[model samples]
Target: MQLARIHHLLQVAILLAVMVLSIWLIGDVLMVVFAATLIAVILHNLAAMVERRTRLPYWLALSLVVVVLLAAIGGLGWSSGPAIAEQATRLRIALTTQAHSLRGQLNASTMGRTVLDYLPQSLGGNQAGGGDNGMGSRIAGSMTGVLSSAFGAAGTLAVILIAGLYFALSPALYVNGLLRLIPPGHRPAARTLLLVAGRTLWAWTAGQALDMLVVGILSGVGLWFIGVPLALALGVVAGMANFIPYIGAFIGAVPAILLGLSQGTREGLLVMALYAAIQFFEGNVMAPLIQRHAVQMPPGLTILSQTVFGTILGLPGLVLASPLTAALLAMMDRATPPLDEEDRV
Candidate 1:
């Protein structure tokens, strides 16, 4: 009996060492894995819904979901690609001109001048690469870096899609394989908690997607009504940035505000107000309504988790922190018992 207990301890230690070493060795790869898992979970839920509605086989249902997603993406791109490209060009020109003008104004003011002096020379349009002729070289270097990053991103995305499809199609197979690694006595509880986490993630993703859509639509319409240039592009940026939580709206709004200011002070003010109002509604109304049906996280806890994860893993950490926290909360709920019935009443 003592020998068996010692052997079990050895096994546990070995597993722990392997896990820690794997994490230390390929942390970025783990980020891709976690992201793929989340996407797979969301796709699984959609595929399940499709299967129910159509009475299709599981694989067929999953394929149908993928097909629909690809079709929708293609349709949207085909319809709006030209307009977005044109607006993006105009936005770039407007932002560059406005940024230069703002830098000039800041350089002219007493306090602003001091701030600019202390700021990096790069902010003042001084190239770090040095010399007037180096501008062409700097641009070339930047283009190369951009192309490299684009290719890297494309490869990562392809990996994620393929992995997610596999997980979505054979989730139970993987889940069972995972369960086999646990002690027999604990597997039941682990399985139950896994289901809870899945439900929480599905609800969270659905709610967030809805929120993104609403914000994008409202922002686009609001900006268009106010005669803001490139409203569509700004709205799309707003929607995408909304994925990041607290600071996301502000990040999305900055470009719009800058572009609006390029037009006039009134336009800038109007754009700022529009974003503020939309954010207020989202925070006070939409979020609460969604959370009531989904996961209800304390704002402070959520923000704190985002900060810690962002520090550790950068963008992917910031993006996945909330859902991961939600999963942890679900596990805690499963592990902890409720108060006595009398106290509950």
Candidate 2:
């Protein structure tokens, strides 16, 4: 019996190793699947909320949620699509212009000239105003303009949405089937693990959504009040980037501050101060409230997980890292009981 248990452990270890290697070697499909899972979790929770509150059938509630989401998206696009597009264009133009202007100023000073040498020449056109200048041209260029779409293509997006919908529609089918694979005695613990993970993920997602909305509102209102150009566009970028944790705040702030700097020294300082204040509010005021139900992920471990996952899985990995870590930590914490050491001998 002891030998048999050892063999089982080895098999489980080997299987886990193979899964890790597979994800590292060809992570695209896994990333797509993981993205779908996130979508399903979000949908399932929202539908559950709707079902309980309205005393509606789960399926009917889910259907209504889907329809409502689609309609909200369509309505927003119809009403504000043109304005968003215009703002995006303006944001790009402003970044390029400022990049060149900064480059020119740097070229004028000795230390600045030395610093410019490390950066890519593409940020600045052949002259102050010329074509072929986009902020995303080079990494050695400005950071803010480097934001790329995480959703790879239309087909992948469609697959994610469809798969997520199917999963959300019948999540129990998958969970129960997975539970069936476990040993009968272990099934209860496995179920507990799954429940903890799911609840953690859902709470984390909810907290993140709230954070994003607050950031968007604060940034938009603050920038507009300060007379920043492309305020709406900058706010949108900031809010979206907040999804990534600490690194994201820096990513969202650079372009706004740089553009402000292009206008004047005081403007630049104000933009910098604005972002600092926002970060302060998020970390001190919002984080505790947000973490009330969600697992409290330490700043250090959170960043470490982001680095590790981001390295392995790329953009999708980076975006989901914090939540994934939270789920993993919750599961680990609940894995066993704390008790006196056993004396089986």
lDDT of each structure? 0.83, 0.83
The residue pairs in collision within model 2 are none
How well does candidate 2 match the true structure in TM-score terms? Answer: 0.84
Give lDDT tens digits, candidate 1, residues 75-128: 988999889888888888888898889988887888877777677576673334
Worst 10 residues of 2 by lDDT: 139-148
Pairs that collide in candidate 1 are: none
Model 1, poorest ten-residue lDDT window? 139-148
**Model 1 misplaced regions, further than 4 Å:** 1-25, 117-151, 338-345
Model 2 whole-model lDDT (C-alpha atoms) = 0.83
